[model samples]
Target: MREIQYEEFEEKIIEIRRTSKVTKGGKNLSFRVVAIVGNKNGKVGLGIGKAREVPEAIRKAIADAKKNVIEVPIINGTIPHEVIGRQDASKVLLRPAAPGTGIIAGGTVRAVVELAGIQNILTKALGSTNPLNLAMATINGLKELLDPRKVAKLRDITVEEVYKGVRREGNA
Candidate 1:
Protein backbone atom coordinates (compact mmCIF):
# COMPACT_ATOMS: atom_id res chain seq x y z
CA MET A 1 0.00 0.00 0.00
CA ARG A 2 1.18 3.49 -0.72
CA GLU A 3 1.27 6.31 1.81
CA ILE A 4 -2.07 8.12 1.76
CA GLN A 5 -2.99 11.45 3.26
CA TYR A 6 -6.38 13.13 3.26
CA GLU A 7 -4.84 16.22 1.71
CA GLU A 8 -3.35 14.25 -1.14
CA PHE A 9 -6.60 12.78 -2.42
CA GLU A 10 -8.96 14.54 -4.76
CA GLU A 11 -12.61 14.89 -3.78
CA LYS A 12 -15.82 15.08 -5.82
CA ILE A 13 -19.43 15.36 -4.78
CA ILE A 14 -21.47 13.00 -6.89
CA GLU A 15 -24.95 13.91 -5.80
CA ILE A 16 -26.87 15.73 -3.08
CA ARG A 17 -30.43 15.21 -1.94
CA ARG A 18 -32.41 17.13 0.60
CA THR A 19 -34.92 15.82 3.06
CA SER A 20 -37.38 17.50 5.40
CA LYS A 21 -38.58 15.97 8.61
CA VAL A 22 -41.91 16.68 10.17
CA THR A 23 -41.55 17.58 13.82
CA LYS A 24 -43.44 19.46 16.51
CA GLY A 25 -41.06 22.37 16.07
CA GLY A 26 -41.82 22.57 12.35
CA LYS A 27 -39.56 21.07 9.67
CA ASN A 28 -35.96 19.96 9.95
CA LEU A 29 -34.04 20.17 6.72
CA SER A 30 -30.94 18.08 6.07
CA PHE A 31 -28.69 17.44 3.09
CA ARG A 32 -27.41 14.07 2.10
CA VAL A 33 -24.31 14.12 -0.02
CA VAL A 34 -22.70 11.28 -1.96
CA ALA A 35 -18.99 11.99 -2.01
CA ILE A 36 -15.98 10.24 -3.53
CA VAL A 37 -12.33 10.55 -2.56
CA GLY A 38 -9.39 9.18 -4.48
CA ASN A 39 -5.61 9.39 -4.64
CA LYS A 40 -5.58 8.62 -8.41
CA ASN A 41 -3.15 5.83 -7.60
CA GLY A 42 -5.58 2.90 -7.34
CA LYS A 43 -6.96 3.94 -3.93
CA VAL A 44 -10.49 5.21 -3.77
CA GLY A 45 -13.60 5.31 -1.55
CA LEU A 46 -17.25 6.30 -1.60
CA GLY A 47 -19.27 7.80 1.24
CA ILE A 48 -22.70 9.18 1.98
CA GLY A 49 -23.20 11.78 4.70
CA LYS A 50 -26.19 13.75 5.91
CA ALA A 51 -26.05 17.04 7.77
CA ARG A 52 -27.92 20.26 8.24
CA GLU A 53 -25.39 21.99 5.99
CA VAL A 54 -23.85 21.03 2.65
CA PRO A 55 -20.20 21.73 3.47
CA GLU A 56 -20.48 19.87 6.74
CA ALA A 57 -22.10 16.97 4.96
CA ILE A 58 -19.31 16.93 2.37
CA ARG A 59 -16.65 17.02 5.07
CA LYS A 60 -18.27 14.20 6.94
CA ALA A 61 -18.66 12.25 3.71
CA ILE A 62 -14.96 12.59 2.92
CA ALA A 63 -14.02 11.44 6.40
CA ASP A 64 -16.37 8.52 6.16
CA ALA A 65 -14.97 7.55 2.77
CA LYS A 66 -11.40 7.62 4.05
CA LYS A 67 -12.37 4.99 6.58
CA ASN A 68 -13.70 2.81 3.77
CA VAL A 69 -10.88 3.29 1.29
CA ILE A 70 -10.08 0.41 -1.08
CA GLU A 71 -7.14 -0.24 -3.37
CA VAL A 72 -7.80 -1.40 -6.95
CA PRO A 73 -5.54 -3.50 -9.17
CA ILE A 74 -4.24 -1.24 -11.90
CA ILE A 75 -2.04 -2.54 -14.72
CA ASN A 76 -0.82 -0.17 -17.37
CA GLY A 77 -3.31 2.34 -15.97
CA THR A 78 -6.21 -0.05 -16.47
CA ILE A 79 -7.82 -3.12 -14.97
CA PRO A 80 -6.68 -6.69 -15.55
CA HIS A 81 -9.99 -7.97 -16.91
CA GLU A 82 -13.69 -7.43 -17.29
CA VAL A 83 -15.73 -7.34 -14.08
CA ILE A 84 -19.23 -6.56 -12.94
CA GLY A 85 -20.57 -5.36 -9.60
CA ARG A 86 -24.04 -5.06 -8.24
CA GLN A 87 -25.38 -3.08 -5.31
CA ASP A 88 -29.12 -3.07 -4.75
CA ALA A 89 -30.68 -2.49 -8.17
CA SER A 90 -27.53 -1.00 -9.67
CA LYS A 91 -25.05 -2.91 -11.80
CA VAL A 92 -21.75 -1.61 -13.12
CA LEU A 93 -19.66 -3.35 -15.76
CA LEU A 94 -15.99 -2.49 -16.11
CA ARG A 95 -13.49 -3.55 -18.75
CA PRO A 96 -9.82 -2.81 -19.38
CA ALA A 97 -8.93 -0.74 -22.42
CA ALA A 98 -5.97 0.52 -24.39
CA PRO A 99 -3.76 3.32 -23.08
CA GLY A 100 -5.31 6.02 -25.24
CA THR A 101 -8.95 5.00 -24.94
CA GLY A 102 -9.49 7.30 -21.98
CA ILE A 103 -12.39 6.81 -19.54
CA ILE A 104 -15.59 5.67 -21.22
CA ALA A 105 -18.11 6.08 -18.44
CA GLY A 106 -20.94 8.28 -17.29
CA GLY A 107 -21.20 10.58 -14.27
CA THR A 108 -21.05 8.23 -11.29
CA VAL A 109 -18.84 5.59 -12.84
CA ARG A 110 -16.53 8.25 -14.24
CA ALA A 111 -15.93 9.85 -10.85
CA VAL A 112 -15.16 6.52 -9.24
CA VAL A 113 -12.87 5.29 -12.03
CA GLU A 114 -11.03 8.59 -12.37
CA LEU A 115 -10.16 8.62 -8.70
CA ALA A 116 -8.96 5.03 -8.91
CA GLY A 117 -6.37 6.39 -11.39
CA ILE A 118 -7.86 4.42 -14.24
CA GLN A 119 -7.14 6.34 -17.41
CA ASN A 120 -8.07 3.71 -19.97
CA ILE A 121 -11.22 1.66 -19.48
CA LEU A 122 -14.82 1.16 -20.55
CA THR A 123 -17.90 1.00 -18.34
CA LYS A 124 -21.61 0.44 -18.61
CA ALA A 125 -24.37 0.96 -16.08
CA LEU A 126 -27.25 -1.44 -15.98
CA GLY A 127 -30.50 -1.45 -13.99
CA SER A 128 -30.46 1.50 -11.61
CA THR A 129 -29.06 4.87 -12.53
CA ASN A 130 -29.05 6.27 -9.01
CA PRO A 131 -25.74 7.89 -8.24
CA LEU A 132 -25.29 6.35 -4.79
CA ASN A 133 -26.05 2.84 -5.97
CA LEU A 134 -23.93 3.24 -9.07
CA ALA A 135 -20.97 4.50 -7.10
CA MET A 136 -21.23 1.65 -4.60
CA ALA A 137 -21.47 -0.85 -7.43
CA THR A 138 -18.44 0.64 -9.12
CA ILE A 139 -16.43 0.30 -5.92
CA ASN A 140 -17.60 -3.24 -5.52
CA GLY A 141 -16.39 -4.05 -9.02
CA LEU A 142 -12.97 -2.64 -8.26
CA LYS A 143 -12.84 -4.59 -5.01
CA GLU A 144 -13.07 -7.80 -7.01
CA LEU A 145 -9.91 -7.29 -9.07
CA LEU A 146 -7.06 -9.76 -8.43
CA ASP A 147 -3.51 -8.90 -9.36
CA PRO A 148 -1.98 -11.06 -12.07
CA ARG A 149 1.08 -11.84 -9.94
CA LYS A 150 -1.10 -12.97 -7.08
CA VAL A 151 -3.13 -15.19 -9.35
CA ALA A 152 0.02 -16.66 -10.81
CA LYS A 153 1.35 -17.49 -7.34
CA LEU A 154 -1.91 -19.15 -6.38
CA ARG A 155 -1.86 -21.20 -9.59
CA ASP A 156 1.77 -22.27 -9.19
CA ILE A 157 2.80 -20.62 -12.41
CA THR A 158 4.73 -17.59 -13.57
CA VAL A 159 2.94 -14.39 -14.59
CA GLU A 160 3.87 -14.92 -18.22
CA GLU A 161 2.64 -18.48 -18.05
CA VAL A 162 -0.67 -17.40 -16.61
CA TYR A 163 -1.06 -14.84 -19.41
CA LYS A 164 0.30 -16.89 -22.26
CA GLY A 165 -1.47 -16.28 -25.60
CA VAL A 166 -3.49 -13.46 -24.03
CA ARG A 167 -1.25 -10.69 -25.29
CA ARG A 168 -0.74 -10.07 -28.96
CA GLU A 169 0.55 -7.12 -30.93
CA GLY A 170 -2.18 -4.55 -31.71
CA ASN A 171 -4.61 -6.59 -29.64
CA ALA A 172 -5.39 -3.74 -27.30
Candidate 2:
Protein backbone atom coordinates (compact mmCIF):
# COMPACT_ATOMS: atom_id res chain seq x y z
CA MET A 1 0.00 0.00 0.00
CA ARG A 2 1.18 3.51 -0.74
CA GLU A 3 1.36 5.98 2.11
CA ILE A 4 -0.36 9.20 1.09
CA GLN A 5 -1.28 12.47 2.73
CA TYR A 6 -4.94 13.24 3.35
CA GLU A 7 -4.75 16.33 1.13
CA GLU A 8 -3.74 14.16 -1.78
CA PHE A 9 -7.16 12.49 -1.96
CA GLU A 10 -9.85 13.70 -4.29
CA GLU A 11 -13.40 14.01 -2.99
CA LYS A 12 -16.77 13.77 -4.70
CA ILE A 13 -20.23 14.34 -3.28
CA ILE A 14 -22.54 11.66 -4.67
CA GLU A 15 -25.84 12.74 -3.08
CA ILE A 16 -27.30 15.21 -0.66
CA ARG A 17 -30.76 14.75 0.84
CA ARG A 18 -32.62 17.00 3.17
CA THR A 19 -34.24 14.96 5.90
CA SER A 20 -36.84 16.05 8.43
CA LYS A 21 -38.02 14.65 11.74
CA VAL A 22 -41.43 15.31 13.22
CA THR A 23 -41.32 15.93 16.94
CA LYS A 24 -42.88 18.07 19.68
CA GLY A 25 -40.70 20.93 18.45
CA GLY A 26 -42.42 21.16 15.09
CA LYS A 27 -39.82 19.65 12.69
CA ASN A 28 -36.10 19.21 12.65
CA LEU A 29 -34.36 19.49 9.32
CA SER A 30 -30.92 18.11 8.52
CA PHE A 31 -28.78 17.50 5.47
CA ARG A 32 -27.32 14.11 4.66
CA VAL A 33 -24.34 13.81 2.33
CA VAL A 34 -22.84 10.80 0.63
CA ALA A 35 -19.16 11.27 -0.10
CA ILE A 36 -16.51 9.31 -2.02
CA VAL A 37 -12.77 9.91 -1.55
CA GLY A 38 -9.77 8.53 -3.37
CA ASN A 39 -6.11 9.19 -4.02
CA LYS A 40 -6.27 8.08 -7.69
CA ASN A 41 -3.52 5.63 -6.90
CA GLY A 42 -5.40 2.53 -5.76
CA LYS A 43 -6.97 3.79 -2.53
CA VAL A 44 -10.60 4.82 -2.06
CA GLY A 45 -13.30 5.22 0.56
CA LEU A 46 -17.04 5.95 0.95
CA GLY A 47 -18.83 7.81 3.71
CA ILE A 48 -22.16 9.34 4.73
CA GLY A 49 -22.61 12.31 7.02
CA LYS A 50 -25.56 14.25 8.40
CA ALA A 51 -25.78 17.74 9.83
CA ARG A 52 -27.85 20.92 9.74
CA GLU A 53 -25.61 22.47 7.10
CA VAL A 54 -24.29 21.16 3.81
CA PRO A 55 -20.69 22.26 4.30
CA GLU A 56 -20.44 20.73 7.74
CA ALA A 57 -22.04 17.56 6.49
CA ILE A 58 -19.55 17.40 3.63
CA ARG A 59 -16.63 17.89 5.96
CA LYS A 60 -17.86 15.12 8.20
CA ALA A 61 -18.41 12.84 5.26
CA ILE A 62 -14.90 13.48 3.93
CA ALA A 63 -13.42 12.71 7.35
CA ASP A 64 -15.44 9.53 7.64
CA ALA A 65 -14.39 8.50 4.16
CA LYS A 66 -10.72 8.92 4.94
CA LYS A 67 -11.13 6.61 7.88
CA ASN A 68 -12.62 3.79 5.81
CA VAL A 69 -10.13 3.79 2.93
CA ILE A 70 -9.52 0.56 1.01
CA GLU A 71 -6.82 -0.40 -1.48
CA VAL A 72 -7.68 -1.40 -5.05
CA PRO A 73 -5.37 -3.43 -7.26
CA ILE A 74 -5.08 -1.53 -10.53
CA ILE A 75 -3.24 -3.11 -13.47
CA ASN A 76 -2.35 -1.04 -16.52
CA GLY A 77 -4.97 1.55 -15.53
CA THR A 78 -7.72 -1.03 -15.11
CA ILE A 79 -8.86 -3.63 -12.61
CA PRO A 80 -7.22 -7.04 -12.34
CA HIS A 81 -10.46 -8.91 -13.04
CA GLU A 82 -14.22 -8.68 -13.19
CA VAL A 83 -16.31 -8.48 -10.03
CA ILE A 84 -19.79 -7.79 -8.74
CA GLY A 85 -20.40 -5.82 -5.58
CA ARG A 86 -23.68 -5.56 -3.69
CA GLN A 87 -25.12 -3.07 -1.22
CA ASP A 88 -28.75 -3.52 -0.19
CA ALA A 89 -30.50 -4.04 -3.54
CA SER A 90 -27.83 -2.27 -5.56
CA LYS A 91 -25.43 -4.42 -7.57
CA VAL A 92 -22.41 -3.03 -9.42
CA LEU A 93 -20.64 -5.15 -12.02
CA LEU A 94 -17.05 -4.01 -12.72
CA ARG A 95 -15.10 -5.23 -15.74
CA PRO A 96 -11.58 -4.41 -16.82
CA ALA A 97 -11.32 -2.77 -20.19
CA ALA A 98 -8.53 -2.61 -22.72
CA PRO A 99 -6.20 0.37 -22.59
CA GLY A 100 -7.63 3.60 -24.07
CA THR A 101 -11.21 2.40 -23.61
CA GLY A 102 -11.72 5.10 -20.98
CA ILE A 103 -14.40 4.70 -18.32
CA ILE A 104 -17.84 3.60 -19.45
CA ALA A 105 -20.13 3.95 -16.46
CA GLY A 106 -22.95 5.91 -14.88
CA GLY A 107 -22.30 9.14 -13.00
CA THR A 108 -21.92 7.58 -9.57
CA VAL A 109 -19.83 4.66 -10.74
CA ARG A 110 -17.68 6.94 -12.85
CA ALA A 111 -16.86 9.18 -9.94
CA VAL A 112 -15.72 6.26 -7.82
CA VAL A 113 -13.74 4.55 -10.56
CA GLU A 114 -12.04 7.71 -11.77
CA LEU A 115 -11.04 8.65 -8.27
CA ALA A 116 -9.56 5.19 -7.80
CA GLY A 117 -7.13 5.89 -10.68
CA ILE A 118 -8.86 3.61 -13.18
CA GLN A 119 -8.63 5.07 -16.67
CA ASN A 120 -10.25 2.16 -18.45
CA ILE A 121 -13.23 0.20 -17.17
CA LEU A 122 -16.83 -0.86 -17.81
CA THR A 123 -19.53 -0.87 -15.17
CA LYS A 124 -23.18 -1.92 -14.97
CA ALA A 125 -25.47 -0.91 -12.17
CA LEU A 126 -28.13 -3.48 -11.33
CA GLY A 127 -31.17 -3.42 -9.02
CA SER A 128 -31.40 -0.17 -7.03
CA THR A 129 -30.35 3.07 -8.69
CA ASN A 130 -29.99 5.05 -5.51
CA PRO A 131 -26.77 7.06 -5.55
CA LEU A 132 -25.71 6.04 -2.04
CA ASN A 133 -26.31 2.37 -2.70
CA LEU A 134 -24.59 2.50 -6.06
CA ALA A 135 -21.51 4.18 -4.62
CA MET A 136 -21.30 1.58 -1.85
CA ALA A 137 -21.63 -1.22 -4.36
CA THR A 138 -18.83 0.21 -6.49
CA ILE A 139 -16.53 0.45 -3.50
CA ASN A 140 -17.43 -3.06 -2.43
CA GLY A 141 -16.60 -4.41 -5.88
CA LEU A 142 -13.22 -2.66 -5.85
CA LYS A 143 -12.48 -4.02 -2.40
CA GLU A 144 -12.97 -7.54 -3.71
CA LEU A 145 -10.14 -7.22 -6.25
CA LEU A 146 -7.16 -9.55 -5.78
CA ASP A 147 -3.56 -8.89 -6.75
CA PRO A 148 -1.91 -11.46 -9.03
CA ARG A 149 1.14 -11.81 -6.81
CA LYS A 150 -1.00 -12.40 -3.73
CA VAL A 151 -3.10 -14.99 -5.50
CA ALA A 152 -0.01 -16.82 -6.74
CA LYS A 153 1.53 -16.85 -3.29
CA LEU A 154 -1.69 -18.14 -1.74
CA ARG A 155 -1.80 -20.96 -4.32
CA ASP A 156 1.90 -21.79 -4.02
CA ILE A 157 2.55 -20.96 -7.66
CA THR A 158 4.54 -18.41 -9.60
CA VAL A 159 2.87 -15.24 -10.82
CA GLU A 160 3.52 -16.25 -14.41
CA GLU A 161 1.82 -19.61 -13.81
CA VAL A 162 -1.26 -17.85 -12.48
CA TYR A 163 -1.55 -15.82 -15.64
CA LYS A 164 -0.71 -18.72 -17.97
CA GLY A 165 -3.56 -20.83 -16.52
CA VAL A 166 -1.27 -23.83 -16.27
CA ARG A 167 -2.04 -26.51 -13.70
CA ARG A 168 0.59 -28.69 -12.10
CA GLU A 169 0.45 -32.44 -12.84
CA GLY A 170 -0.46 -33.29 -9.26
CA ASN A 171 -3.00 -30.49 -8.85
CA ALA A 172 -6.46 -30.38 -10.32
Candidate 3:
Protein backbone atom coordinates (compact mmCIF):
# COMPACT_ATOMS: atom_id res chain seq x y z
CA MET A 1 0.00 0.00 0.00
CA ARG A 2 1.15 3.51 -0.77
CA GLU A 3 1.93 5.78 2.12
CA ILE A 4 -0.84 8.20 2.93
CA GLN A 5 -0.14 11.88 2.50
CA TYR A 6 -0.42 14.16 5.48
CA GLU A 7 -2.99 16.37 3.78
CA GLU A 8 -5.15 13.38 2.93
CA PHE A 9 -5.51 12.20 6.50
CA GLU A 10 -8.08 13.31 9.06
CA GLU A 11 -6.99 15.02 12.22
CA LYS A 12 -8.80 14.56 15.51
CA ILE A 13 -7.99 16.61 18.56
CA ILE A 14 -7.93 14.22 21.49
CA GLU A 15 -7.29 16.48 24.45
CA ILE A 16 -5.89 19.83 25.50
CA ARG A 17 -4.65 20.86 28.90
CA ARG A 18 -3.33 24.03 30.48
CA THR A 19 -0.40 23.27 32.74
CA SER A 20 1.16 25.53 35.31
CA LYS A 21 4.53 25.46 37.00
CA VAL A 22 5.72 27.50 39.97
CA THR A 23 8.73 29.62 39.23
CA LYS A 24 10.77 32.22 41.04
CA GLY A 25 8.96 35.16 39.47
CA GLY A 26 5.50 33.71 38.82
CA LYS A 27 3.61 30.71 37.51
CA ASN A 28 4.57 29.45 34.07
CA LEU A 29 1.69 28.57 31.81
CA SER A 30 1.68 26.20 28.89
CA PHE A 31 -0.74 24.16 26.85
CA ARG A 32 -0.49 20.48 26.02
CA VAL A 33 -2.48 18.69 23.33
CA VAL A 34 -2.92 15.14 22.11
CA ALA A 35 -3.75 14.68 18.46
CA ILE A 36 -4.59 11.66 16.29
CA VAL A 37 -3.96 11.51 12.54
CA GLY A 38 -5.42 8.98 10.13
CA ASN A 39 -6.89 8.27 6.73
CA LYS A 40 -9.50 5.85 8.14
CA ASN A 41 -7.74 3.35 5.86
CA GLY A 42 -5.51 1.22 8.04
CA LYS A 43 -3.08 3.98 9.00
CA VAL A 44 -2.90 6.22 12.06
CA GLY A 45 -0.65 7.94 14.58
CA LEU A 46 -0.79 9.73 17.92
CA GLY A 47 1.30 12.68 19.04
CA ILE A 48 1.60 15.03 21.99
CA GLY A 49 2.60 18.68 21.79
CA LYS A 50 3.05 21.45 24.31
CA ALA A 51 3.23 25.16 23.60
CA ARG A 52 2.33 28.51 25.01
CA GLU A 53 -0.89 28.61 22.98
CA VAL A 54 -3.60 26.09 22.13
CA PRO A 55 -3.44 26.51 18.35
CA GLU A 56 0.31 26.16 18.26
CA ALA A 57 0.14 23.09 20.45
CA ILE A 58 -2.46 21.51 18.17
CA ARG A 59 -0.44 22.29 15.05
CA LYS A 60 2.69 20.84 16.56
CA ALA A 61 0.79 17.77 17.64
CA ILE A 62 -0.52 17.24 14.11
CA ALA A 63 2.93 17.58 12.60
CA ASP A 64 4.41 15.17 15.07
CA ALA A 65 1.58 12.73 14.51
CA LYS A 66 2.15 12.78 10.76
CA LYS A 67 5.78 11.91 11.30
CA ASN A 68 4.88 9.00 13.57
CA VAL A 69 2.22 7.33 11.44
CA ILE A 70 1.92 3.53 11.41
CA GLU A 71 0.18 1.15 9.03
CA VAL A 72 -2.28 -1.28 10.61
CA PRO A 73 -3.10 -4.76 9.35
CA ILE A 74 -6.85 -4.55 8.73
CA ILE A 75 -8.76 -7.81 8.28
CA ASN A 76 -12.40 -7.31 7.39
CA GLY A 77 -12.55 -4.06 9.41
CA THR A 78 -11.00 -5.65 12.49
CA ILE A 79 -7.74 -6.93 13.98
CA PRO A 80 -6.32 -10.32 13.07
CA HIS A 81 -6.03 -11.52 16.65
CA GLU A 82 -6.34 -10.50 20.29
CA VAL A 83 -3.48 -8.58 21.87
CA ILE A 84 -2.62 -6.77 25.06
CA GLY A 85 -0.24 -3.83 24.83
CA ARG A 86 1.42 -2.09 27.73
CA GLN A 87 3.28 1.18 28.06
CA ASP A 88 4.59 2.43 31.37
CA ALA A 89 1.64 2.06 33.75
CA SER A 90 -1.01 1.73 31.04
CA LYS A 91 -2.33 -1.38 29.32
CA VAL A 92 -4.75 -1.77 26.41
CA LEU A 93 -6.47 -4.95 25.33
CA LEU A 94 -7.70 -5.31 21.75
CA ARG A 95 -9.90 -8.00 20.20
CA PRO A 96 -11.49 -8.49 16.82
CA ALA A 97 -15.27 -8.29 16.64
CA ALA A 98 -17.88 -9.46 14.15
CA PRO A 99 -19.19 -7.12 11.50
CA GLY A 100 -21.44 -4.32 12.83
CA THR A 101 -20.10 -4.69 16.35
CA GLY A 102 -18.67 -1.19 16.17
CA ILE A 103 -15.93 -0.02 18.51
CA ILE A 104 -16.35 -0.94 22.15
CA ALA A 105 -13.97 1.38 23.93
CA GLY A 106 -13.68 4.53 26.00
CA GLY A 107 -12.40 8.00 25.12
CA THR A 108 -8.69 7.51 24.56
CA VAL A 109 -8.65 3.92 23.36
CA ARG A 110 -11.67 4.52 21.17
CA ALA A 111 -10.12 7.51 19.48
CA VAL A 112 -6.93 5.63 18.67
CA VAL A 113 -8.67 2.47 17.47
CA GLU A 114 -11.22 4.34 15.38
CA LEU A 115 -8.57 6.47 13.76
CA ALA A 116 -6.73 3.29 12.81
CA GLY A 117 -9.70 2.29 10.63
CA ILE A 118 -10.95 -0.54 12.81
CA GLN A 119 -14.75 -0.58 12.37
CA ASN A 120 -15.37 -3.57 14.65
CA ILE A 121 -13.38 -4.18 17.82
CA LEU A 122 -13.50 -4.72 21.57
CA THR A 123 -11.14 -2.73 23.79
CA LYS A 124 -10.50 -2.47 27.52
CA ALA A 125 -8.15 -0.27 29.48
CA LEU A 126 -6.41 -2.50 31.94
CA GLY A 127 -4.04 -0.26 33.90
CA SER A 128 -3.55 3.49 33.81
CA THR A 129 -6.20 5.88 32.57
CA ASN A 130 -3.69 8.46 31.44
CA PRO A 131 -4.58 9.45 27.90
CA LEU A 132 -1.00 9.61 26.71
CA ASN A 133 -0.10 6.20 28.08
CA LEU A 134 -3.35 4.69 26.88
CA ALA A 135 -2.84 6.03 23.38
CA MET A 136 0.70 4.68 23.24
CA ALA A 137 -0.44 1.32 24.50
CA THR A 138 -3.14 1.18 21.88
CA ILE A 139 -0.59 1.96 19.21
CA ASN A 140 1.65 -0.75 20.56
CA GLY A 141 -1.19 -3.23 20.26
CA LEU A 142 -1.70 -2.36 16.62
CA LYS A 143 2.01 -2.63 15.99
CA GLU A 144 1.97 -6.18 17.28
CA LEU A 145 -0.55 -7.37 14.69
CA LEU A 146 0.72 -10.17 12.45
CA ASP A 147 -0.48 -10.60 8.90
CA PRO A 148 -1.94 -14.02 8.15
CA ARG A 149 -0.36 -14.09 4.70
CA LYS A 150 3.05 -13.41 6.16
CA VAL A 151 2.55 -16.16 8.70
CA ALA A 152 1.54 -18.54 5.95
CA LYS A 153 4.65 -17.75 3.97
CA LEU A 154 6.78 -18.29 7.04
CA ARG A 155 5.17 -21.68 7.55
CA ASP A 156 5.56 -22.69 3.90
CA ILE A 157 1.84 -23.00 3.22
CA THR A 158 -1.00 -21.16 1.56
CA VAL A 159 -3.28 -18.98 3.68
CA GLU A 160 -6.30 -21.27 3.35
CA GLU A 161 -4.21 -24.34 3.93
CA VAL A 162 -3.18 -23.04 7.30
CA TYR A 163 -6.72 -23.60 8.58
CA LYS A 164 -7.24 -26.99 6.94
CA GLY A 165 -8.88 -29.39 9.35
CA VAL A 166 -10.22 -26.65 11.57
CA ARG A 167 -13.60 -26.83 9.85
CA ARG A 168 -16.11 -29.68 10.19
CA GLU A 169 -16.38 -30.31 6.44
CA GLY A 170 -12.65 -29.98 5.85
CA ASN A 171 -11.22 -31.82 2.79
CA ALA A 172 -14.64 -33.14 1.83
- Say which candidate scores most in lDDT: 2
lDDT, candidate 3, 46-118, per-residue tens: 8889999999999999999999999898999999889998999999999999999999999998998888889
TM-scores for candidates 1 onward, in order: 0.90, 0.94, 0.90
Model 2 per-residue lDDT at 153? 97
lDDT of each prediction vs. the true structure? 0.92, 0.94, 0.90
Taking the tens digit of each residue's C-alpha lDDT, what string does model 2 give over 105-165?
A: 9999999999999999999999999999999999999989999989999999998898799
> Which of candidates 1 and 2 reaches a greater TM-score?
2
Consecutive 10-residue window with the lowest summed lDDT within model 1: 163-172
State the TM-score for model 3: 0.90
- Model 3: pairs clashing at backbone N, Cα or C within 3 Å: none
- Tell me the deviation in Å of residue 16 in model 2: 1.1
Q: Which stretches of candidate 3 lie over 4 Å from their true place?
A: 1-7, 163-172
Clashing pairs in 1: none
